[model samples]
Structures are given as C-alpha cells and as structure tokens.
Target: MPVKYQQETAQITWEAAQALIEAVLKEGAAQKIAFSIAVMDAGGHLRAFGRADEAAFLTAEIACDKAWTACFFGQPTHIWNSLVQESHMAPLASHPRLMAVGGGYPIFYQGRLIGGLGVSGGTYEQDQEAAVKALSFTGFDKL
Candidate 1:
C-alpha cells in the first residue's frame, strides 16, 4: 500500500501584500515622507512593490534587498545592525543583500513566519515606523 502526504506552509497572498503596501504608503504620506516599499514571500521572492513619485530611484533596489535580507534571516534588519557591529560578526555587513538597517522587518501570521516587508526613502527611523505601522494594520501586532 502507498500513502500520500502533504505539508502546509504559510504564505502572503497577493491581496494581503497589496493591502500592506497601501497601508505603508498611507502612513508615509501622513508623515509627509515618500518611500519605496517591497514585500517578499517566505521563499524570499518579491511579491509586490510600490514607489512614491518623489522617492529616489535607488530606494527601489534598497527596499527589495532589505525585504530579502529580513526574510533570509527570519529577523528584522535593524537587529542585524547591532549583531554585526560586534567585531566577530562584522563581516555580515559585507554581504550584497544584507542591509543592517531599520527599514526591514519579518512578517508573522498566526505565529508563523509568512513574509517580509521593507520601506526605504526617509530616515531609518521613519522607514521602520512605516513598516511597523503597516504590519500593525495587518493585525500582526496583536499576535
């Protein structure tokens, strides 16, 4: 006899990604800041992206890399900044896609890691605030 088995994984749906991006954009506008935002699925693949009209061209790539970095490490990029500052871990800063900044955050749903979100354009603190605000809108903050 043979048996069939399946595995379940959490993922960020396109609708959810769009909503997250919209929330981030609204937060940026409310704060009088413009930013480029990127969303990545659990596999680190780009799911959705948006850039404000006045945002810098470079911010698009930066935001994508930040999202990938957060998903890759399963942790926020800002946390990596502190970790990499230690002499022994300083080399991590040299990685091409590893941005040790505050704009990137891992997304969680129902206690499961689902995706990542990144925002770039304003100050690091502003970027972080926008990302957090978006995540909160998704109700991830309640988890």
Candidate 2:
C-alpha cells in the first residue's frame, strides 16, 4: 500500500493585511507622520500596501523590500542590521532587496510564520513603532 503526502503553509489573508495597513496608517496620522506600509505573504509576495500623503515616493519600494527581507529571514530587519554590524558583515547590508532597516517584521500566528509587515517614510524608531502598533492590532505582535 502507498500513502499520500500533503504539504501545508500559512499565509496572510487579505482582510488581515488590510487591517494591518489601516492600523499603521492611523498610527502614522496620529503622529503627524506620513508613511508607506507594505504587507507580504509568507512566500514574500506582496499582499497589500498603502502610502500616506506626502510620503517620500521612494518609500513605496523601500517598504516592499523591507517586507521581503523580513519574510526571507524570518526575523525583524533591525535584528539583522545589528547582527551584521556586530559581526562586521557589512557586505551583507549591500545586498539587493535585503534591507536591514528597523521597520520590517516577520508576522507569526499560532507559532507559524504567516507574513511580514514593513513601514517606511519616517525615522527608524518611528517606523518600528508604527509597524509594531499595527501588528498588535492583528494579535501577531507577541509572536
């Protein structure tokens, strides 16, 4: 007898992505800051995005790259930045599509990696704050 095998994967749903983006936008508005937010699926595919008025035009792409980097590494980009700096691996920071910035975070649900969130167009601390705030609303920040 032969057995069948199956594979399963988790992804960030459209509704959740929209909610996260909205929350980030609201946070940015409250801070009187403009931002570009991007959400990417576990496979590093773009799911949703938003850019606040007056945000830098380049932020759109930067936000996406940040999200991709987070999903790719399964960790916050800031952590990667620190690791690179501490290890003196400066060359890794120059890699294309791998931004070790402070605004990118990998999203997890029930111990499973679901997706990534990226926020840009503000200082690193500001962007990290907005991203974490948005993730908190989705109940994914603690993971």
Residue-level lDDT of model 1, residues 1-143, one tens digit each, is 87668668789899999998999889989988889999999999999999999899999999999899988888888888789989999998899999888899988988888888999999999999899889998787432
| lDDT of model number 1 | 0.90
Please give the lDDT score for candidate 2.
0.90
Assess each prediction's global lDDT (C-alpha) against the native: 0.90, 0.90
**Candidate 2's error at 67, in angstroms?**
0.6
Candidate 2 local lDDT, 28-137, one digit each (tens): 99999899999999999999999998899999998999999988889888887777786578778778999888999998988888899999989989999999888988
Clash-forming residue pairs, model 1: none
Q: List candidate 1 stretches off by more than 4 Å.
A: 1-6, 141-143
TM-score of each: 0.91, 0.91
TM-score of 2: 0.91
What clash pairs does model 2 have?
none
